[model samples]
Target: MSPDSVLVRWLPVSAIAEADWPVLSALLPEDEQARAQRFHFRRDWESYTVAHALLRGTLTRLAAAAGHPVAPPDWRFSIGAHGKPEPILPEGVPPFRVNLSHTRGLAAVAVALDREVGVDVEWLDRTNLTIDLADRFFAPAECAQLVGLAPEAEKDALFAFWTLKEAYIKAVGMGLALPLGAFAYTLDPLSIAFDDRIQDDPDSWYFQRLRPTQGHVLGLALRHEAPERAMLDAAPAGLAALLRLAG
Candidate 1:
């Protein structure tokens, strides 16, 4: 795709089916197809399959839009020492980057080139947030903010903060290896900032709340060097549209 283009799409896992496998299959190189199949067996078959399909479909659409072949490119991806996925860029094709996340029934894919990006989403369940667990997983300041919230609003706000933090950590690609308790995120509903530990690399991270739904909250994270605008689309038809666009 053009260097300026940034694509983000969200797909519902429930909307995917066995019939859609062919579309996703067409996007994988022979090797990835095998690896993905194994990943399915090791995880929840339905969740893994659906997540893979959504990513494949989104990438296919992105490639098409860039006038590249709709099929998977020659690049290879391997997990970093810290468990972040990184592309083994191949020759000839334009540099391309992608990030994937799935939670509950929703899957999201973010694609661009020349910059690193990360995205994440989670289904919110207020009942799941316990003060003790929050203390263990959240920064002390975050816990204080959570405790100050009105009882009914606390769960939702806590979740929003959790999601934003997770999204930020994922964007950095260190996953849980990075200490969550070391950094504090602002309690603002739609925005978050890191504590002193991240101040040196402040521009490399950003977080934003996405459209919320019953039992769910979504978020996106990207390096400041990447495009500021992020496009989001819902499932089924959205996945199809993204594929067609890439094609």
Candidate 2:
């Protein structure tokens, strides 16, 4: 892995067999396991389980790669002022920032060294993606760009704009307190413009959109690292393999 790379990883929830779920769930801390159990549907439970397990596994690998050597179960997390979960590392270890998102059948995580990073993945067939929703949540210019686009293309652009904005807010760690309309994004070249209400430099951030699978779209945002590009790990090892595999 290059020092300048942002490692992006995703795993399909369905890939983990029912029998293997307990093994993967075992990797999670007790609190996370309790949260997973709170989901009303088993599918949601599995998604949350795989997502956080993926996060811990990836963090273990990244921390060790940086010479800190923290085990998956031993890693601790603290929530930010908003609700973003942040890793707690030992003193003298360089700062490692991470963010993860999971939706329906997919889970994704992004990790960066000494830089803030946020990632979002959404299932493509969401029924709520509509112009009215865009008008309500997106910047005026962003919503305007969606107009006149073909139906399929419009959905693609909507998710692109949505995930990018989501990535930005998550990276900021302010959650919904930061209005989505305060900053606008443009496609083709992919850039952002901010309104007076928000204080951020567009140049200090980097954004990328990718289709990790045919059914999912992923967005990545990192701060203070313009030239740093995200590199997706092909896939996480199988659920059973995940436990025995060394970071």
Candidate 3:
């Protein structure tokens, strides 16, 4: 696939840690170093440590693709009014956006040359946790759809829908502060719609349910119109090669 095409990559959390941090660290700017230090990793290094490192590595490679310096600026990121991480963009570069999600040792990253994007993954456990949380987080119509599913199949489908919604919201950079209860998704798996309660412009948002994997469901969302064809690449060497120019 062309390097300019929209690409999605899934990196196992374990494999990310195995990557050389020094190689990764060389790509990070001083601001990134301070952000890494602020995290309290002693309690839950798996999420913050692994996710942060993977994000840095992925962004380093992405910046290279845009022909920008691999080193990011010393800009500090502050939460938006809606509580989403907004990195201070460096001057003279094309707009670049990324969103990260990890669940059960699997991490997914979505990168766009000049558009905002988000990706999310979830483990399909047999537990009733998703169903319980749906009541609080899901929209009324979504809950209705979940309740209508056959007892044996409801749990899996609910998670698939939930992940898609989450990715959509995060893609918009609003996070949970944006009311999820205000929007409803279709059962067809190809589209999502917002109700009157959602205050944002829905026209720019797009969502798709990815092929299911063993014990996992994946979803991706973006703010641009859907691409004619989407490509998935899993080669770490391809990513590493993109970053090697800065070395």
RMSD after CA superposition, every candidate: 3.8, 2.2, 4.1
Instruction: List TM-score per model, in order.
Output: 0.77, 0.92, 0.74
Tens-digit per-residue lDDT, 1-247, candidate 2: 4545677888888787677787788788888899989999988998888888888888776667778777677779899988898888887555778899999899988887767788898999888978889999899999889989999999999999989989999998988899999999999788899999998888878788889889999998888645545444435435554666332
Predicted model with the maximum lDDT: 2
Report the backbone clash tally of model 2: 0
Q: What lDDT does each candidate get?
A: 0.62, 0.82, 0.62
Tens digit of per-residue lDDT, candidate 1, span 67-115: 6654453446778766666656544446767777777666776666665
Q: How high is the lDDT of residue 129 in model 2?
A: 78
Ranking by TM-score: 2, 1, 3
Better of 2 and 3 by TM-score: 2
Candidate 1 off by > 4 Å: 1-6, 21-43, 73-75, 126-128, 189-199, 225-237, 241-247
Error of 1 at 115 (Å): 2.2
**Model 3: worst 10 consecutive residues (lDDT sum):** 234-243
* Candidate 3 deviant stretches above 4 angstroms: 1-5, 16-43, 72-78, 126-128, 148-152, 200-203, 211-215, 225-247
Model 2's TM-score against the true structure: 0.92
Candidate 2 has an lDDT of 0.82
lDDT comparing candidate 3 with the true structure: 0.62
